[model samples]
Target: MTEEEIIRPENLVYKKPTLLNDTPMHYCPGCSHGVVHKLVAEVIEEMGMENKTVAISPVGCAVFAYNYIDVDWVEAAHGRAPAVASAIKRLWPDRLVFTYQGDGDLACIGTAESIHALNRGEHIAIIFINNAIYGMTGGQMAPTTLMGMKTATCPYGREADLHGYPLKFTEIAASLEGTCYVTRQSVHTVASIRKTKKAIRKAFENSMNGKGASLVEVVSTCNAGWKLSPEKANQWMEDNMFKFYPLGDLKDTATANDSH
Candidate 1:
């Protein structure tokens, strides 16, 4: 079929999100950042918030999100995306504001900023990408690195006596009174991707509706950092990662309020 005929509305099964620009992403092979970016772009476009959205990108693998997603973006210092997002959201209450951050940036250096922002009930969403290890920084041990998981900084595996346990920031966010929604999700399969997309949409809606803070943690994979192929990485995440960071809504005050 001709290109035009193949892309006709009636013949289309799916299409790329209009908010996703043609710029090539710099993520490593099998990186989860690309998929999450696409989902964010899709959600923004679907909500008709393309012109009224502001994204905060901080240092890490997703720092370059502004290059691909066609949205107003602010580049923040390492671990400070939450603070910047809070300022932006407060200044422009009508805009849909969010921060895209990796585990190392959110759970480690930005721990205080993240906690306070969510605790204060900022009208914004935080998209947390937890791949365990620090993917962009030479695969070092991250705050969310699973116990016993090997990384460059933990060649002999993470020892409880030396490294402490992995931080479950999502659970912490859920416990905060200011948080209206919190969910842990993944994109390893078609079904999981669909669910994650739904979770992201709900968080965005809650933010725009003057609800309290929301967080969507995506349990992700880093094949290069883990020294595994794409297929093996997916399997490893399913077998190992999910055991500790199981998927589901940790809190859902938004839906609860709606039902009442």
Candidate 2:
């Protein structure tokens, strides 16, 4: 077959997004972080927001997120992504600003910063990645770690009596008046990946539309931390994590919400 015949747009099933840099990803094989990063880049490219998009990436495995996504980036302290994004959004209200954070960073050390920023109705999209346990931080018990889930910090499994219950930060975000959109999603399946991209796109659109704080909580998995293979990790997430962090929209007031 001729190269032109094989490379036609109709024949192409997929193409790498330009917003995703040429750098090789450091994420492990089967890591959802890589997929999520691609989704974000695709959304930005589709919206033509590459130049205007400013991503604030905080601590944890996602701290190096700025390395992958080709856009203006600001590295925030652990749990300070919301605060940083809030400032950037305010200083340049016309710019599309967002934060990519993990459970340990958003729900734990930066809980107050995340809550207040969302409560105040900042025009920012918060892409919160909830992987249950602290993945990059030695698999420690994060605030969103399910009860009875074992971790490096909780060797015998998390006990409600000592560790407390898992925090539903996204649910809280939905309840906050400052937030205009809040949803929980995953990137394990092809269908779920499409939904997540839509959710992320809506979030960025909301920021540009001045819909206030929009949070898209992606319920992810950590195979290394969970001591499971990528396949088992995804399966475990579907079986157990979904119960605690179910998929679907928790809240939506964005104008584009009705359109798609």
Candidate 3:
């Protein structure tokens, strides 16, 4: 009838996933990378892929993801995770290969590689974290940064003439002929977390089944980079980020009537 009693296995409603290491996460207080990482770890454990999965992580805020997850990881050059994953998946067709990358790494510097990998239909999963600002690099502007959003590189706010436009990379991935599934999700609330977890699981499943490429794009919050409190960041994300990058399945070739 106390704290220990409530934490007892018989009364416990939730517990940390075993695949997640005991080490403390380095993500910022309100950042969503930790949540997404936990979900990925849970899915891997639930799927019994701890021994057959490989994660390729690139530079960005979530770059240290391998330190937290108990799995095989290959640290890739900046913006080269997808290409690295392609080679790994080719050599080990039976293993589940995936890439964990951020917006700057995927939508900007690695745009060509990310697109070509998906278009080629490599049997791999891609977990993309889109937090408008570049969180790890002094809050600079990224390709996914919303119009008028201010960042270190855009002190006066992003302008169309100078910044072009926010890239819809998920939609672009969905348009590819090779991608088996592509979905965009967020993790600000319990319901959203559940949805994102499900999407991530689907991505892993698709890869394991040789169904071609699958991309799970997580629209995340970077409170520290945004110069806002955790709560305000979530509120701002819902108010601004969600508008341009709505949550939904961009593509689902597995469910389509036409054969892949």
Candidate 4:
């Protein structure tokens, strides 16, 4: 069979219910955002939360995530997904609420919103994708950009003196008394993707259980921003990003094991 026939629409089995409207994605080749988008949809299907779930889209590469994840979603102002999530969850306390955001939007522009949201102990799940650099804004230096990392605006490589240290968001979230679940996982490999799906599902479950705030920080890849092939990009995330954002549960056991 031809390659097209191998991946035909009918050949694909979507076992889970997806609220995502039918539309093609605009992500670059080898982008992990697409994989993550699919994982969220799958989790929503598995948990039967698509009808009662609401997602919040951020301002970075994933700003259009609402189009791909089958669920009710709102577009939040840059760096304000957490705030938007708080508002939505407050209004509809029974809904399973989440926010899909990138490092640039979550760690930089939205730092205040993020910190305050967690501090307030809102009932919502946060799906944070840390790709290191700014993927959408022409590969600029993001707050999570590692030292010695090269980006369009940092051709000389990011330096501690100038760019500051890599922000450990999971660690920060873990410190919050209100945060119920905090885990850092990756989507760079099959094993890691399996773990990431579990983390995502756990976060959603925590939200449904009214367990306060939950954050799953996904160490994802930005192939275009990193200027690496898909294989190399995944390798970089596994080797480098994993060192900084280790995979595991960082908070309460109930929320951590909710998916299981």
Candidate 5:
């Protein structure tokens, strides 16, 4: 077939999301951020909420998410994305507001903000990226770092006597009454990527419908920080990360309400 014939709409099997710009992502090879970004772009575009969507970008590796996704974006201070997203969502009830945050940003300094915003049932969505280690700042230890996992700050590996255990923030989110939907997902495989995309789309839909708050935690990988190749990182995540942070929905009041 000719190039033009192959390019025909009827022959096209897949295409890049229009909401995703031509900007080359800076995420390292094998990083999960790029896959999650593509999922977000596809979900937003499919929902036809491009013009009405507002994203609160965190101060971590995903800070530049605004550059790749074509949407209204607000840069939040370190660990303050939930607060900013809450405010925007309150002021513009009609707009779809969401926050993209890392484990360090959302579970450490922004813990209070994240908990309170969800507790208060803010009409917004929180997309949490938990890669265990701090990816942007030299692979330092984060609140979600698994036990015995070594990082720049935890060179001797994390010890309960000193660093404490990894925090399961999504589990806590599931307990909150304000949370309409809380789920943990991953993007390491094609099936998981599809599920994660569905989870994100559900969260966005809940936010736009003012169904309280939603938290979608994506268990991710940091190959560069872990000093492993992309392939090994995926294997490591499946072997170790999944053991500590199992995938699936923690809570889903939305589905319950639908059943009624």
Candidate 6:
């Protein structure tokens, strides 16, 4: 089928492309960040927050996310997206605010910012992209790098004595009293994409309802960094990454509030 036939106007009625820009993303083929971006944009469009949404992009491969998200975005300093997000949300309490950060940006350099933001009960959404390796800076050793995983800096494999352990960011963030909704999902396949979209929509909706900080960690793929074929990289994330970052809702107070 032709591209026009696939994204026909009728099909785009409710499922329109909320993401912006005509240029293709710089992500390697089969990268999951693109899917995650699409999911977030769709949720914003569905909720009619296109004009009210603001996003902070981290200093990673996703740094250029502003070009694609079509929302008013601020390019934050490395590891400072959370700080920027906090300020933006506070300055304009009526706007829906979020930050898109990678494992290195969020789990490593921005660790303190992330923890404090969640701890402060900031009503913002965090789209955490955990691919285990630092994708933008030549696949360096990231804080979330798995034990025994090899990287540019850790060619001998990640050693506990030197590199430390992989971070369970969602779990840690959820533990904070400020976070109201926390979940981890993946986008390796069509079915997984659907599930991720649901989780992302819920997170945004919860934040809009005055539900404090919400986090949605997306276990993503880095075919180039992992040195695997596109299909193989996805398979690897599904098998290994999912094992480390299990998929599910960590907290859902709104649904619980309604049900109770």
Residue 65 lDDT (model 5): 93
Task: Please provide, for model 4 over 140-188, each residue's C-alpha lDDT reduced to its tens digit, 9 standing for 90 to 100.
Answer: 9988988898999889998898878889988999999779888888877
For residues 44-95, could you state the per-residue lDDT of candidate 2 as single tens digits? Answer: 9999998998999988999988888989999998899999998989899999
Off by over 4 Å in 6: 1-8, 11-18
* Worst lDDT 10-window in candidate 1: 7-16
Q: For residue 71, give model 3's deviation from the true position in Å.
A: 0.1
Better of 2 and 3 by lDDT: 3
Off by over 4 Å in 2: 1-4, 8-10, 255-260
Q: Over all chains combined, what TM-score does candidate 3 have?
A: 0.96
Candidates in order, TM-scores: namely 0.97, 0.95, 0.96, 0.90, 0.97, 0.93
Off by over 4 Å in 5: 1-10
Tens digits of per-residue lDDT, candidate 3, 49-143, equal: 89999999999876899999999999999999999999999999989899999999999999999999999999999999999888998999999
Error of 1 at 118 (Å): 0.5
lDDT of 4 at 247: 85
lDDT assessment of candidate 5: 0.94
lDDT of 1 by residue, 30-81 (tens): 8999999989999999999999999999998979899999999999999999
lDDT of 6 by residue, 148-182 (tens): 87888999899988877888999998789999889
Candidate 1 residue 168 C-alpha distance from true site, Å: 0.4
lDDT of 3: 0.93
